[model samples]
Target: MDKNISFTLKIWRQNGPKEQGHFDTFQMKDIPGDTSFLEMLDILNEQLIEEGKEPVVFDHDCREGICGMCSLYINGHPHGPATGATTCQLYMRRFNDGDVITVEPWRSAGFPVIKDLMVDRSAYDKIMQAGGYISIRTGAPQDANAILIPKPIADEAMDAASCIGCGACVAACKNGSAMLFVSAKVSQLNLLPQGKPEALRRAKAMISKMDELGFGNCTNTRACEAECPKNVSISNIARLNRDFIKAKLKD
Candidate 1:
């Protein structure tokens, strides 16, 4: 059986993007070790409501960690101390009694604060819309073996596709670079036969979109790869750079 723990939470609160924000402290008592981080927040919000106070606002969806909606900066880590796990996967047991836990939202010029822990990640959607996909004609489904992608290449593509667009990369980087995210998205399609048609166009368009949105340039800090919940590699950035240069040469 899991034991219960207690902690002091210092959470960032804001009324809106243009409003003032500050850290509001609260004491969490007797929280179950197995309770996920979001659940503990639910408890805290419930207590605040009982006291007739406004509940803290944060973003979350599909607590199982797939949706990547839990964009929390916990205890100086982008999703707590656990590696390759989203904020929703963090559990109370990761803490100790009387520990002071700090929680904040993703901080980046590209991701403006929507309220408290929620930010306007719609910039990512705009980046994706710019050129994140291959334009394929509608027809009957193609046979799986017809494309005949090698296992190693397919695995690499899958690795890149694992990115859930959580924006932790931007949150952790001192430069707030989205290279890891964009590179991963680009590489996923770039390695396959179908995506090769627009490889140059996709690379140039996506990188241009990323820059137009005010995301910082990559400085090789590697912080994004270190803090990524999906363990996305920095290698994809190299591929993206190569593709971008080649595309420019063609233009």
Candidate 2:
């Protein structure tokens, strides 16, 4: 059902990384049901600019949810209250007409707020470069049938490969653990035949890089799985644990 909502928005505002931040409130009337969370933010920004105030700055790219750039901590929930939905996919209809929504950036030591709602998640990219991808040759690529991966292994790898590295797992976790994200990335490669040659190496290198980046340890609390937009299994974390142990033993 389409409805117009009148809500009060409380958004975090900051000038830069070292600046003191505060919550700024704005009220709007007749917000439509079809307006996305970012769309709502857009409306608020337009209003703020009209008032000669700086608009709240947040990260967003490819509003279709693939880019994983719309990292919003909305009303105490990462990516708002929508299950399996990114911030860009969140609509204002989910909120009450008189709701006061609190919007902020992802809070983690590794993901510090750069300005207002925009944070630096490039730490994830650094960890990936440390060891998230497979190392293939510059020579001719193998044929699709050359690898001949069995269905079960391929499917499992695909499932793990679905991780978007959105860092929701880290944000939702009490200890700020990134096990789900790292595990999925590691397990995806480890599950496949093509990934076998560097399986142990990949596990060891990725985990080491993760630790070096100062990500907190997992305590099995499962807040990560609960908030993972991709629904990545915690069992993959177990797989990473086992792989890490095996790699250490082989050292």
Candidate 3:
């Protein structure tokens, strides 16, 4: 049976993007070890509502770790201390009784905090809109085996396609660079036949948009890969650099 534990939560509180933020302490007692991190927050919110106090604000959706909406910086790690997992997947069992857990929003210039733990991650969407898709139609959907993609190449593309746009890379990076995210998106599509025609243009446009949005340049620190929930590789960044340089050379 899972035992209940107690802890102190020091969560960041902010009214708006421009407002100053600070930590608000809350005591959580007798929490089930199996309770998910988000479930614990829900219990706290319920307690606050019953007491007629304002509740903490945070972003979460599809708690199954797919949407990447839970942008929590828990104890200095993006999405808690769990490896290859999102915040929603984190459980209280990871911490011991009476531990002081600190929760904060992603502290990047590109991902400004909206209120408390929620930040305006629309910058990612904007970067995607810049050139993350293949506009050219590859005709009607055909059989999966028709394209004749080799196993190794197809596997690499699938791995790159696993990026969920969580922005954990930005939060973990000392330079707040989005190269990992952007590179994953680029590699997934560029590796396939349908996206090959415009691979260079796609890479160039997305990178330009990332820079225009004030995201920092990649400095080879590889912190982004270390903290990425999907473990998106920095090698993709190298591929992005090669593609970008090729595009520039053509110009």
Better of 1 and 3 by TM-score: 1
Predictions in order: lDDT = 0.94, 0.87, 0.94
Clashes of each: 0, 0, 0
Question: How well is each residue in 1-251 modelled by candidate 2, as lDDT tens digits?
Answer: 77999989888988888889899888889999999999988988898899998888988889988888888888988898998878888888899989999988788888888999998888889888877888887988778787788888888888888888888998898887778998999889889876778888988888888888888999999988888777888999999999889989989
lDDT computed for candidate 1: 0.94
Candidate 1 vs candidate 2: the lDDT winner is: 1
lDDT of 3 by residue, 1-251 (tens): 68999999999999999998999999999999999999999999999999999999999999998998898999999999998899999999999998999999999999998889999999999999999999866679888887888888889899999999999999998899999999999999998898899899999999999999999989999888888888889989999999999999999
lDDT of 2 at 27: 89
> Which stretch of 10 consecutive residues in model 3 shows the poorest summed lDDT?
136-145
Local lDDT at 65 for model 2: 80
RMSD of 3: 1.1
RMSD of each: 0.8, 1.2, 1.1
TM-scores of all predicted structures:
0.98, 0.96, 0.97
Residue pairs with backbone overlap in model 1: none
